[model samples]
Target: MRFSTLKSVYQCKCPRCHQGDMFLRGKLLNPAQFSVMNKNCSNCGQSFEPEPGYYFGAMFISYGINTALFIAAWVALSVIYPDYSLKLLLALLGLTVLIFLPFIYRVSRSIWISIFVRYKDEDLPSSA
Candidate 1:
């Protein structure tokens, strides 16, 4: 079955075919392995990194995601503890960043690639 672009992105699937994984399986929480990605799409053979520095723009995406996370954390802390100290806020922000680094990194790359790679609805080759 065909998957929607948003679904494919959320699943971290190849942007073109939406079948192959963009990143290594079961590695999201593994700090060392979290950033590892498949060299190419197993189904469409699209290069995950089209060229050197291709992911430079993805860094900006990551920054935006982190900013949102920080804002959310600050708002939550404000509501949960009205008198929370600056130290507490800093600690919470640090913890939030550590907890969400992997997710943000992966999603940023997925979004970056999706911007350039359009989905294709066509029969896969005999060999994937």
Candidate 2:
């Protein structure tokens, strides 16, 4: 069985063909185009934007991801350093979230799109 859908999400590939990259190639630290995406899948001609305001849903996904990351960080820090102050823990969490914001933004959009799109085996041959 093809796990291309799962692979696509993690790799940030096109959902239809799992070949074309979802976002444009650029330095991860380049905030200018970090979340910039191709209008269509280069391999399958699948449109990235199905409708206007489509990516608005991705904000929810991003929020959930950040929340989970925060909780995990807090729990791990508490366990590793039992005497750490709340202020310090919050500061660390803030820094961590800020540093990973761009990554999380791209990932959340990839995940959101994958939820509504599925890989088609027929698109595979044409993609190649």
Candidate 3:
């Protein structure tokens, strides 16, 4: 319904309330493994995964966020960690991001979709 509400979903916390785990996988998603979300929240009974590809948009959102964060982290580390070599810092950030790449991708998509979901309010039970 609001940007703040949507961001909470992007945080990979509960989409319904932002207070619970959005993911049952301990805040991660496996593209190859395909972790499925319950159609509705266990706590609130509100729909979480609304439809197929509902999370695809979050991919674009995630890419933008991750890229920006990486760049910022690079700048911050370069300035703050004066002793560390630039190459080393880059390498470490690269490896860390790479390790969590799948999760980032999934989360970005999930959050992006969640924004629209708030506006659409398509949680009503399907008539079909």
Candidate 4:
């Protein structure tokens, strides 16, 4: 099922249903359903992707983005939330990474085709 909003490009689906919003409100808090994808298309009821291996690249994408976010976060925390013990800082950072990993995985996989996906029918839904 597609859970993506518009432009499947950034979606879990084609953008025509009850879903698309994973979070209750602000993005700072983790999304509610980080590991869940819609069971069926919200609109046409068609499968979101044609097959497996379809999302293989998603892992790589997620890794890259996650790494970047982690680095940025550690740097920011090191600068802003300074004064904590080294062990405590490291532990907090580790916890933070774990907390964000699943969410980032979802977003990265959801937007995996952002760079290469296309559609013959402009009217057709896309994951752009």
RMSD to true structure for each model, in Å: 3.0, 2.8, 5.3, 6.7
lDDT of 3 at 9: 60
Any runs in candidate 2 off by more than 4 Å, and if so which? 124-128
User: Candidate 3 has what TM-score?
Assistant: 0.58
TM-score of each predicted structure versus truth = 0.92, 0.87, 0.58, 0.58
Question: How well does candidate 3 score on lDDT at residue 114?
Answer: 60
Determine which window of 10 residues in candidate 3 has minimal summed lDDT: 119-128
Candidate 4's TM-score? 0.58
Candidate 4 C-alpha lDDT tens digits along 5-57: 33454434333342333222243344554565554554455344558666688
For candidate 1, the TM-score is 0.92
Which ranges in model 3 have alpha carbons more than 4 Å from their true place?
1-7, 10-13, 17-20, 25-36, 81-89, 99-107, 119-128
What is the lDDT, from 0 to 100, of the residue 93 in candidate 4?
65
Per-residue alpha-carbon lDDT of candidate 1 for residues 47-118, written as tens digits (9 for 90 to 100) = 999999899999999999899999999999999999999999999999999999998999999999999998
Global lDDT scores for all candidate models: 0.91, 0.86, 0.64, 0.56
- Please tell me which model should have the higher TM-score, number 1 or number 2: 1
Error of 4 at 17 (Å): 10
Candidate 3 achieves a global lDDT of 0.64
Ranking by lDDT: 1, 2, 3, 4
For candidate 2, lDDT tens digit of each residue in 74-102? 99998999899979998989998989898
Which wins on TM-score, candidate 2 or candidate 3?
A: 2
